[model samples]
Target chain A: MDADVRQMTWTELAALCTNLEKACTKQLKEEEARAFASLASFYASKRKAQGDASLDDLLALIEADLSTGYRSANEAANYADDRGAKRALLWGEKATKLLKSLLARYAKQKEALTADTGVFVCEICGFVYVGQQPPEVCPICKVPSFKIHEVKKEAI
Target chain B: MHAARNLRLCTKDCVCLFICPTGATNTETGQIDFDKCLDGCRLCVDACPSGAIYLVSSTYPAPQPKHPSVLETLYSLVRSKAAQEDVAHSVKEGSDDAALRQICTVVETSSRIIAEDLWRESGYIIAQSEATRALLKAMISEHGTMEGFPRTEVEELLSRLS
Candidate 1:
């Protein structure tokens, strides 16, 4: 797995991780699950070895591209004078802002944060909030406490 | 093009109402009536105190499809994200921990959204790809035989693409 991943370019590896991400979301057959596990391990191993390499930057760039959807949606809404489209874009913009904020926080505190500290993400909107406990209500998506989930910062 | 209000951001200052020449900006709904709005008039957009109003075009030109390689990469990502979402769903099912369950659900939802976004970017969405024209043509030919298919719209798009 290591040798295979090593042979690929950083872009290719990133693409693999991205594809794996989507594949993991769908209902997986046992064979696919094993394949996913192998790929996930390979990705993790590569990232650990590379340490702040181009792959890391590529992932960030990919995540940041979520904003493009908001921009286009807003433009479409404006063109057609569609209030529903605009409202959907508004939610999307809020979610994007939350993602940016979470990323910024993670970057700023990467050095200071310990393994024990919790990173909460809102289930309804994917809003990442770093702290011991999730917020009472997600500021972005307005999901309640039951909807907030704590994840390892590394996993996020 | 005309100005419209995002009511969520509107502070109800009524500056848009004051600035709009055609009285398109209304206090009741805190929205601009598109029928009454003057084309290319942006007075309300410029004068909105809360920055809630902005001008937008009524229609946009067809967007060129991205490079084939870029489109392929996006499609690959869409599948990848779907895979991850499945993993999250499975984890959510077994987890007794509330926070963990919540996190898994969120991951699943977000991954799906990302996957859909990539799919849209991968030359499948209308107004963003010539591939859409082809797809429309194929779908109409295959499915239009069933009934209720908007064969006319598909025909128009095919002609436009040609």
Candidate 2:
């Protein structure tokens, strides 16, 4: 019951959501069950959408990530030791720079930027790379190719 | 280890209240009294029907040292998630549609939680070593010049960590 969402695949998450919905229904909590049903659907759709996400949706997600990065930077400063804080700062700066570049490119060639290229993120550093494949190693974090994850579009 | 309750999962069976010999779980506040709780006591934890009660380690293991490159990458991912949270928060604040707002709120919360987890994995949450302080100082001096960088927060954090 105590599952880590980060570790779960989208299908697993959808299954968990469906199971929770069933559990809620068993408890006669109809409203909660309905909410879980919706969540289950959302995850299912998100898995299907994957690389097929629209430009606007992708941009919006990137923007959201940028905001999240800023907050993480602050938290790292506050709670993390000096090394953690330094790394967080570096990550924040790099992500901001990358996002700015992406926004600029999007503004200039909206359709071209989204054309067929897949969006990949470095699992270690959160560096977003738009290409057919992620780099051999992350330029920002120096991690190998396996650590880079593909960005799946959520069907919200 | 001491027992704690997850209020969300709690069914209010009150079995813990009766089973806890030290009365640590029988408090006006929902939280278990750590001071009164006996180490390795499992009476209340085993008695709870809803499985809401669980033990938390009173002492944490020393954090492993992460490579500087790895730490940077981990923190970067944290930043990315945090940025997403900010975007979700803005959407939540600006959208008039209730459903859209709810979705945005969820996204915001989820992203923040993920970011916190990443922070913890970076070896900065539980214990601060001297290396951590030195790293913070180096960051302030090197990266503080970047636009919109939170130099003040870093400085404040440095003082607190000290």
Candidate 3:
């Protein structure tokens, strides 16, 4: 019998999360394309909410980034490398960068993301960006700009 | 750090097996023997043609505990993503379009990832609070009679917590 999630060790949780990421990667590649509009929206809203929430200010968000965000990215990166999936590795790296950048900006008393800087999303690897244009080559998946879409950041 | 082989990408070229100084790669199970692997030796990682071998860190960084308020925010996000995932799953079920299915799958995957992050940081695993105890007790009550619930492990966990 499988142990309950709460009872499982950190290693078990890591393995399960890695399997989830690997399965997600397989689906994206086999389908020949991908879409992350809903996922991206979910994350953007979460980030915005964290920024707006008054519970202990940015400390809560910073702590979460240090604990959950960084660890998740590490697990995903290792799993992606093991599975030989460059796209998955890139997405994990992006997640780590997002967390670090947020922490840095918040520490300096600046907004992590500005209203004018648009969100550029990679269709293949779900890498999100706030920039003037999509990158020449996606750092995560190495895909060209054609595969990256400029998403609306007005609401977020 | 020592090299570990990813069997999925391993072409059975035996490159790692030949390159490993400690014979850690020439195992019956096809996995490198971590105990025998030399520290900082990445010979197999470099020699592998398929890029399957990579160095893994044996020691993980210390856990940074997040504040409960942060956990609350994460829980809210998890709930939102979970609801979105449910909607996408339903849409995928109802639609015949391949594109829709693919989109739904991506949504579902991302939602799961977010959910897992919340779960990890929620203090649900450490038995540190009443909430964790309550959750375990509830699970025991609900699935204690079920055959596949790992009742013994659950009971053991509950006992230790108590």
Candidate 4:
């Protein structure tokens, strides 16, 4: 479903999740789970170790958590809907509750990372960097992060 | 050209309506469609003559705090190590904790760098319109160019969401 488009059929989504949950947990269905897991890798893999990784590793855990949470949700929602699928709407309702909790936790973590530009200054000419950390040597003053002044003063 | 800004400046002379080349500049509505405008054509931007039609590039995102001074990011990589230090200091007692903590740090630092890159790439806004300009600006800057950003693994979720 395109998120840009509004509205969805709760029954279809819940059914998808139920099948997804089953596929994710059992050994016979491991390959199917792996495929779904791969879909999730897009969001999870960015945070993994790399030559010049930026996001702290927490992204992967959240990604993984979302996968499981979603799978669990699909299963529960399916159960709720299965009484003749009349309960399909209820399943979607449950899914919302499940996701909101997860979203709140993720939001807190994301807020911390994005609260500021995550920039700092060179102690010398007071040069600032917005990426990960200050350079090994300040291009301007040829000083180190140690020598450069940190913008964040301890509000003493 | 200053669609929204000129909304403030227009004396309702409606001179812009006559000067605009493709009618890309709208006086009554106070909007200009960059997508509709020719690249580097500067007709509307030039037509405004109010100096209000600030030539805007469609490539970047919405305006941000302290637009990207590539110099700044380079400075960070060259001077700071708070990210590395944060990683080093998080000594998890258990194996799982250690691994989880490590991943968290990696994601955090990566997001920070990405945020910087995104901020820089997305900071171009128009002085022209505001109708959907601000909305589109937020969409573009956070999202990216109309041709759009690459389908990187990092942005895969967003792509899916879209």
Candidate 5:
């Protein structure tokens, strides 16, 4: 007997929730894209890295970076398949969790900027998110990094 | 329910969509349509060219033996509402307020999601595999997360483990 014969079954539940997940994921991706773009612009004006390196350049960098991780998980999963569900799940869980942990760590890094005195700022885009307000998720370039203009106040 | 998978690294092998018995796993546009996916079918999870699709259970109990869908819920709602209205009419005519509240509560659940009944996605996790099963066990007992998956389901899983 199907273990979950009582409910809609695992297959059915997956279908219903799949769409909801897609919607949320799309929003998240768009946010990520904008963040990368904004970061790229900041670097361009500050150090003036090179000529016309837009947000796409940064995204290309990210894609290049993640290729190995993506490939590794697939390889691991294949190895697990023959081994059994236990093995498959092991490979899946570890790979997924690793990525999840990475994302969590990245979020923490972005948050570290909170303690800064606000001197060195991102040059490409002079943007700062205030404590009271949530920054706009720039869809086009995708970064909300504050653009620094060298603010000089009282005695330094 | 987050990004079902990391689409960036997806190899576009298109095997998952084909392997999925139901049309649950699909990549219609550039992005995947996770909403169409049927959870627990891991055919796609196994078939995925890249282990991009990561599935996790929510912190709720397993639902009752029979989980009702939107259409089913809607039909039930209409029936419950009518029943409530009938009961309310009776109460107004000669019945008591207690009966009216009972009827009203039933009506409310019919229309909206019955939060209490909707357990987190689980019970199946126990059935996944050894590593996943182990991970799930840790999550259930160690995390102190009450998902509402039936005690029977857990018991059955434990029986198998032993």
Candidate 6:
């Protein structure tokens, strides 16, 4: 299994896990389906951790990128020819703002927050919600609860 | 073109089993054998009750070139997402709590998905395309020296795409 996994690309492995989970669910094997889902997440984490970058370096890089994204979004929004394009760009700008604020908060309160609260990200708009449960609807994009994915420390 | 099945939408209707002339639709493996599948034969695609089956083109159009500024922003965004994935991994490693670890996994996965999307947007739409190959080569030469860059994986991807 390890040899097979090592040979497969991350995308292929993810697809295989997703299909396996679906098969298990179709067979009414709920526990096995959940196990496969967890396995998928675990493998994803393992792949993401392959490099030697320190957490601080990653945080710093993200901060710089977010700042750049914010600036570009603002520029795009200003020049957008159509109202719809401008609105969408503005939404992106707002999302970047939210992400920057979240990153700042996380940096300052990492230890305390990691102890109890889980981070939930809105899949639609990148809104970060730090709490035991995500809001009923995303405040930024108005997506329903199911769209808010919880980020935990480990797979169940 | 060959038939493909989306496992999520497949309803076990078994219509494809009978519709496929080459017996390419195998439910046991949950895959449609591309070699066996007849080109332009979309019987299964039309027959699947749940609309799970579809035809994929064997050839892809050339990727349109992205604007320089757009590519720059996308590259930065991709880097950001990649870094976030690493941060999630680090957080997951630092914690022993099962729930927290699970959340970290979600974070990592989300970052990866976003990075892939950014790559797709930057004209890397077809894995076998020359544009994708050029982009991968450029990434290897440009960012390969960066600390903690996934140089090996990028090289492997370039070889595969070649």
B8-82 per-residue lDDT for model 6 (tens digits): 789899999988898999746797887799999899999999999888775667766555555555555655665
User: Highest DockQ: which candidate?
Assistant: 6
Q: Indicate the DockQ of the complex predicted as candidate 3.
A: 0.04
Count clashing residue pairs per candidate: 22, 17, 1, 44, 33, 13
Candidate 3 structure, TM-score to reference: 0.39
| Superior candidate under lDDT, 2 versus 6 | 6
- Kindly report the docking quality category of candidate 2: incorrect
Model 3 clash pairs? Answer: A90-A140
Query: For model 4, how does the per-residue alpha-carbon lDDT over A1-156 read when each residue is reduced to its tens digit?
Result: 011101212221122222232323322234444433443232232222334432233233334433553344335435444231212222322322332333344346643532443445443233445446667886544665675443331211
State candidate 5's TM-score: 0.22
DockQ of 5: 0.01
Q: How do all the candidates rank in terms of lDDT, highest first? A: 6, 2, 1, 3, 4, 5
Worst ten in a row by lDDT for model 5 chain B: B111-120
Give lDDT: candidate 2, residue B117: 45
List DockQ, one per candidate, in order.
0.05, 0.05, 0.04, 0.02, 0.01, 0.16
Tens-digit lDDT track for model 5 on B79-114?
232232233223323423432233222222221111
* Chain A TM-score, structure 4: 0.23
- Mark the regions of model 3 whose C-alpha exceeds 4 Å error after superposition: A1-156, B1-3, B6-21, B27-30, B34-61, B95-99, B117-144, B147-162
lDDT of model 6 at residue B3?
82
Per-residue lDDT of model 4, residues B58-84, tens digit only: 333333333123323222321122233
Q: Write the per-residue lDDT of candidate 2 for residues B1-162, one digit (tens) a residue.
A: 777787778989999989898989988879788779999998998999999988876444556666554555554665455445555555545545543444344344334434544555465443233544554465456545755445665565556445
TM-score of chain B of each: 0.67, 0.54, 0.52, 0.33, 0.31, 0.67
Worst 10 residues of 1 chain B by lDDT: B120-129
lDDT of 2 at B114: 45
* lDDT tens readout by residue for model 6, A1-156: 011333334443343444445544543445545654654454454454434544465457556655676468346434433333334334444554555565566557655665777777766555666779989987766878887887656443
Q: Which candidate comes out best when scored by TM-score?
A: 6
The C-alpha interface RMSD of every prediction is 13.9, 15.3, 14.0, 21.9, 27.1, 10.0
